[model samples]
Target chain A: MVEIKNLTKRYGGNVALHGISFDIKDHEILGFLGPNGAGKSTTMNIIAGYLPSTSGTVTINGFDITEQAADAKRCIGYLPEIPPVYPDMRVEEYLTFCAGIKGIKRPDVKPQVESAMERLHITDMRRRLIRNLSKGYKQRVGFAQALLGNPKILILDEPTVGLDPAQVSEVRALIKELGKDHAVIFSSHILAEVSAVCERVVIITKGEIRAIDTIEHLERSMTANTLLNLTVEGEKDTALRILKDIRGIKEIKYLNAADGRVSCQLTLEDESVRNEIMSALMANGCNIAEMSMAKLDLEQVFLKLTAQKEKRSSLQDLLDETPDVSGEAPQDAANDTTE
Target chain B: MFALYKKELQAFFYSPFAYVLTALFMLIFSFGFITSIANMDSNTLKFSFPEFFYNNFFYFIFIIPLLTMRSFADERRGGTEVLLYSSPLSVTQIVLAKFLAIVTVFLFMIVLSLFFPIYAACTGKVIWSALICAYAGFFLWGLVCIALGMLLSSLTGNAIIAAIIGEIVMEGLLFLDQVAGSRLVDAYPHLNSVVTWFSMQRRFVYFSQGMFRLEDLVFFLSVTALVLCWNVLSIEKRRYSHA
Candidate 1:
C-alpha cells in the first residue's frame, strides 16, 4: 500500500503540486488522469523518491519515503515520464544492471532478469542494442527495466505514450496482468486506456485533484439530467405534443422535420423518465425510429471538471491583483469538499 | 553500491569511450616520451622515463577533464539519472561508483604507460626505485585531477560546460605556481605564500625527485577525498525539488 498526505511541491515561485492527498491500497490499479502540466509527473516523482516534497509525507507500507528511504524505495519500481535508459547498453545488459541496482540478490538476478524480459515480451530482443531498436521496442525495454526485482508497487508515468496501436494494447494488457498482484499506479491522458484497465481513477488538473472515484460512481454523479435523442418518422406536431404530455421532459429541441422524419432532443428531469416518454409517443400515432440516452463518457467528464476549474481560476485572477491567483483553485476545491 | 560500481565500470568498458580515452592518453604520453628521449643524448645511456609524465602534467589538466566530463553531466542531460535517483542506492554510492570507474580507467592508462619505463630499462640503466616512486606520485596526482573533474561535472548538466569549467580551474591551479614567484605578488608576501602552498606543480617537484613526504601524501589524499565529498553533496542537492 502507498499513502500520501497533504503532499506539496513548489518550484521557486511556482507551485507544481499543491496540498493534494490520495492513497492506493494493495491489489488496486489506480489511474492518474490529468492534462498536460497538471502535476501528474510531479506527484509520481515525489512518490518514487526522485524528488523531495516541500511539505507532507509519503509512506509506502509502514516506511516513510523521506525518513525510511531505502526500505520505502525497495518496494517501488518507477518508470519516469521519459524512459530512463542508456542507449549504449544492450537490452539484456540493461535489464541485468537494473536488477542489480534494484538490489536483487546475486543468485536471483539472472532469473529475475529473464522473467522481466519474458513478461514484457522482449525476450527475443534481449541481445539487441537499445539505441538500434525502434521507439516501440525501446519503450518495451523500458517497461522491462521497471519490472526487474518484481517490487510490490509499480509507478508508471504515461506508459503507453509513444507506441503503435498493437504495442499499446500489448503494454496495457501487461499492466492489467501486473496489477493482478502489484499495486499499480499509472498516469495517462488517454481516457479509454484508464477505463479499460483501472478500477478507480484520480482526476487532477491545475495542481489539484478534481475527483477520485470508480468509473461507475463518477459516471453516476452527473446524472441529474440526461439528453435523449428521439427520431420519429411521423408528423412533427404530433410527436412534439406527445413529448409534452410526458412529465419531466424539461426541454425539447426539434432538430428537423424534413420528409416527415422529425428529430428532437428531450432533456428529461431524470433518466428513469425515458420509458414513460416512449410509452406516450407510442400510445399516440407515431412511428418511433430510435431512442438512446446521451451518456457522459470519461473524456467528457474530465473535460467538464477541468474546464470548470479553469473558469473558476480565471475568474479569481480577474478579481485578485496578484497574477498568481491560480493558487486559488485548491481553495475552491477545499470549499466544495467541505460543503 | 557494488551494483552501481559494476554497472558504471561496464558502461565505460562496453562503449568506445574507454578505448578512445586510452588512445588519447597514450598519444599524449608518447609525445612526452619522444621529447624526453630526444633531450637525452645517446651517449648518456640513461634517461628518467617517468620524468616525461611529471613534465606533461599540464597536458593531463586537459586530458583528465575529457575522461570525467560525462560522469554526472551526461546522466542528467540524458535523463538516465531518474533511474539511479529513484533506486535504493544513495547519492554517495552513485558518485563513488562513477568516481571509482573513472579511476580504474585511469589506472589502466597508467599500466599502459609502464611500457615506457620498461623499454627505457631494457635500452639503458633506469633507476627502478625512483621509477616506482614516480609512478606512485603520478597516480596520486591523477586521482586529484579526476576528483576535480568529477566535482565540476556535478555543478552543471552540460558536459561541455563541465569540461570547460574543469579546464579553467585546473589551468588556474597550474598557473598559480608561476604567479607565486611573479613580480606582481612580490608586494604581498602572504598571498604569495598561500598560492605557493596550494600550487600542485611545485608540490610535484618533491615527488618527481622520488621523495615521499608524509605531508605530501596526506595533501593529495585529503584533497581527493574532499573534492569527492563535495561532488557527492552537489549531486545530492538535485534530489530535492526546490533546493
Candidate 2:
C-alpha cells in the first residue's frame, strides 16, 4: 500500500502541488488525470523519490519516503515522461545496468534482464543501441528497465504518449495484465485510456485534486440529472403536459415543435423510469419516433469537474474579498463528483 | 555505488569518449616529447620526461575539458539523470561514481603516455626520480582538472556550456601562480597569498623539480576533495528543485 498524506511541493514562489492526499491499495491500478501543468507529474515524481516534497509525508507500505528512501524506492519502478535512457547503451546492457543498480543479486542480473525484455517484447532489440531504435522501441526499452527488479509498485508518467494507436493499446493491455498482481499508477491526458485500464482515478487541476473515484462512479457523478432525448409525433403542449405528469420526470422542454414531429429533451430522475415514460407517451396518443439517453463519457465528466473547480475557485476568491459571512469555506465542492 | 561506477565506466568506453581522449593526449605528448629531445642541447633543462610535462600541460588543458564534459551534463541533457535520481542509489553515490570513472580514464591516458619515458629509458641515461615525480605530479594535475570539470558539468544541463565554462575556470586556476606574482597583486597581500595557494602550477612546481613535499600533496588532495564535495552538493540541490 502507498499512503500520500498532504503532499505539497513548491518551486520558490510557484507551488506545483498543494496538500493533496490519496492512497493506492495492493493489486490496484490507480489513474492520475490532470491537464498540463496541473501537478500530475509533480505528485508522481515525489512518490517515485525523484523529487522531495515541501511538506507532508509519503509512505510506501510502512517505510517513510524521506527517512527510509532506499527501502521505499526499492518497491517502486518509475518510467518518467521522456523514458530516461542512455542512447549509447544497448537495450540489454541498459537493463542489466538497471538490474544491478536496483540491487538484484549479481547472479540474477542476466536472468532478470532477460525476463524484463521478454515481458516488454523487446528481446529483439536487446542488442540494438537505444539511439538506433524508434520512439516506440525506446519506450519499450524504458518499460523493460522499470520491470527489471519486479517492484511491487509501478509508477509510469505518460506511458503511452507519442505512441501509435496499436502500440498504445498494446501497452495498455500489458498494464492491465500487470495490474492483477502489482499496484500500478499511471498518469495520462487520454480519458478513454484511463477509463479502460484504471480501477480508480484522481483528477487534479491547478495544483489541487478536483476529484477521486472509480471509473463507473465518475460517469454517474457527472450526470446530475440524466438527459433523455425523445423525437415524438404529437402536439407540443400535450406532449409536455403528459411528460410532466409522470411521477419521475423532473422537467420537459420541446427542442423543435414547429414541424409535424416534435423533438423534446427530458430530465430523468432515474434511468429505471425509461419503461414507465415510454408507456405513458403511448397511452397519451403520442407516437415516440426515437428515444436515446445521452452518453456522458469520462471526457465530459473530466471537463465538467475541471470547469466546476475553476468556477468555484473564482467564487472562493470573491468570497475571500468579503467577510467570513458563511463562517466556513465551501469544502465539499468535489463531493458531487462521486454522486 | 559499485553498479553505478561500473555503468559510468561502460558509458565512457562504449562511446568514442574514452578512446578519443586517450588518443588525443598521446598525440600531444608524443609531439612534445620529440621536440624536447631534439632540442636537448639547446635548452639548459635536459630532455627529462618530467620537464616536458610542464610544456605539454597546454595540450592537456584542452583535453581534460572533453574528458569531463559529459560527466553530469550529458545525463541532464539526455534525461538519464532521472533514472539515477529515482533509483535506490543516493545522490552522493551517483556523483562519486561518475567522478571515479573519469579519473580512471585520465590515469589510463597518462599511463599510456609512459611509452615515451620507457623508450628513453631503453635508449640512454634517464632521470628516474624526476620521471616518477613528473608522472605523479601530472596525475595530480589531471585529477584537479577532472574535479573542476565535473563541478562545472553539474552546474548546467548543456554539455557545451559546461565544457566552455570548465575550460575558462581551469585555465584561470592554471594562471593563479602567475597572478600571485604579478605587480597588480602586490597591492593586496592577502588576495595574492590565497590565490597562490590554490595555484595548480605552484603546487606542482616542487614535483616538477623532483622534490616530494607533503604540504603540496595535501594541497592537491584537498582541492580535489573540495571540488568533488561541491559537485555532490550541487546534485543534491536538484533533489529539492522544481521538476
TM-score of chain B of each: 0.93, 0.94
TM-score per candidate, in order? 0.85, 0.86
Tell the DockQ for candidate 2.
0.76
The residue-by-residue lDDT of candidate 2 on A119-189, one tens digit each, is 88899888999999999999999998888788999999999998999999999999999999899999998
Pairs with backbone N, CA or C atoms under 3 Å apart (clashes), candidate 2: none
Candidate 2: TM-score? Answer: 0.86
Q: What is the clash count for each candidate, in the order shown?
A: 0, 0
- Candidate 1: segments with Cα more than 4 A from true spot: A222-225, A228-294, A310-339, B41-46, B241-243
Worst ten-residue run, lDDT, model 1 chain A?
Answer: A330-339
Q: lDDT per residue, candidate 1, A300-320, as tens digits?
A: 556665655432322112222
How much DockQ does model 1 earn?
Answer: 0.65
TM-score of the first chain in candidate 1 relative to the native first chain: 0.76
- Per-residue lDDT, model 1, residue A96, is 86
Q: lDDT of all predictions, in order shown? A: 0.81, 0.82
Q: After superposition, which runs of candidate 2 have C-alpha atoms over 4 Å from their true positions?
A: A222-225, A228-294, A310-339, B42-45
True contacts kept of 2: 0.76
